[model samples]
Target: MDFSGAIFEGGAYFLKAKFEGGAYFLEAKFEGWAYFLEAKFEGDVNFSGAIFEGDVNFSGAIFETRGMFAHVEKIEEEVKFSGAILNRVFFEDTDLTKIRFYGTAIENAYLAGANFGNKRFIEEREAIDEERNLLQHITKALKKPGLKSILKSMFVFFAFPDNSYRKIKTKCKPISEAFRRAEDVYRNVKLSLQNEGDYETAGEFYYKEMLMRRKRTLYEIKNLKYWLFSHIYSKLCGYGEKPLRVILAAFFVILFFGTFYWLTGTVTGEGITDSSFDYYYFSVVTFTTLGFGDIHPVSFTGKLATMLEALTGAFMMALFVLVFGRKMLR
Candidate 1:
């Protein structure tokens, strides 16, 4: 049944309607509420460029084959699809901020270019409660079969990159349950974006996923060793992104040991020099493992400090090489 370009000025109802063949509603406009309760489409259906000035309900509807509703320009109010089954639906280039998908089965859905709106921090308790309710609705929708695939397809649409880092850290930080699921969602999105050759965006999502993992490890896993390692690896070197951090760390280590040597008077040069410069120079040489015969450590503390500095230098140098190599390769 073709209703292409048809205009329904009043409310439209197709309750329990069955379409055995292709159903077309291209560019249709609904001025009032539109309901398709329990309707079934057995063949391909198209509602591309449709406009609904009022709320649209598709509760209990079923699309057995492929369907398209791409480029829906306007939906005046919320669009409900509770208990609906959609097969291979296309919602590209649509705004879905007010779309409700409670108990909706979205199989092989394509949501590229769709806008899920920005998520802001809700400070008010009432607003937070509302957001929680909304989250619950979305969670219920995600309970469909093949949940991973559905999440992968819809992630890029809903996870818009509007100051995402700050949003995730501040206002839009997911609840514990959502945070766990977000790890998988971000990972899948990253992989998908990478496959599509969007490396820049993929890298951003990868970082977000890593941040989520870090939080999970710190709060949920409660492993101090792993958490410490992750913290150092990430902040000290930005997961191999910032090579300068290595140099900075090395500088601090040199300064600390140099001060120690000066205060303790444990470093000696070939001459009777007890200058700060001499101590600093000795510290640098020792850190670099350059055991110059001109200068040596005199005390046990100096020897221990020298060994520690040498180990630190080697480790930092190795890390710098690895990080630099990774950046260069990328």
Candidate 2:
């Protein structure tokens, strides 16, 4: 189905939809929340100049030909192409603030026109270009030398370019062995741009997706000058922690509940300002797995809170056990 010259200006899409043949969204834009979740694309899909304001979920899609998202122009929210299969992809000239390529595979990709949307990345262009030149020179030098030429082609094809590096490594063992020494450079390029707030962030994510495929991890080091506020906020806001962090998270969540209690109690002077004490006490009891019925809640919201605390306690304890098991056993 040719959707070229058509505009998909809606917020909702049918779940698990299937589109065969080449579907073109060349210059078409998705202006709001959209979903192609579990949708399958069975041919070449072009999304050049398309804009995604919300989440993109092509979870079980198949791009038999190639998928081009080059010059995406704008992607305001997170992009998830997880669990999808692609033959090739182009993402040059995109504004991707946050991207995740978890569990996705691109077999053979060309990223020639791609740009990471920043100046620091622009600065690295010369160094990358120099590496490209060196690759070309080597490719020609070992051209006539039998096995050496095969090794040389591997060096040029899998070494410098950002896209097909890992795919080539997994498919071509001979080439993979020849450039084993360059693994650090490959890892560093991915690690450098792993958690950038600027354009470097997306580049790192994209590069990692290409290099490691499903086994990729995004590296994030809090920038002291920039992320000071955010780091403090996450710590204060329950994120990516277990065991004691779980306990701390419960305390903060209940703190928010206590704050709500304090503000609302002032509205009716007889209302419970005492819920503050109850919040901490409940969290503590919940953390310790106590099932006492003495200080029981009366309101329906309070009952819901009790259930939530109980569930949170169970989750935290499980997390504690799982995470600590890995550390202690290892």
On lDDT, the candidate that comes out on top is 1
TM-score of each candidate? 0.66, 0.37
Candidate 1 TM-score to native: 0.66
For residues 129-217, what per-residue lDDT tens digits would candidate 1 score against the true structure?
22223233233333333332334344221221123233344434344334555566667766765665555555656655666566666
Q: What is the lDDT of residue 272 in candidate 2?
A: 26
lDDT of 1 at 277: 82
* Residue lDDT tens for model 2, 218-267: 11222344345434433432222223565576566656644543444321
Q: In model 2, which runs have C-alpha deviations exceeding 4 angstroms?
A: 116-330
- Find the 10 residues in a row with the least total lDDT in model 2: 118-127
**All models: lDDT?**
0.69, 0.48
With a 3 Å backbone cut-off (N, CA, C), the pairs that clash in candidate 2 are 92-114
RMSD of each: 7.9, 21.3
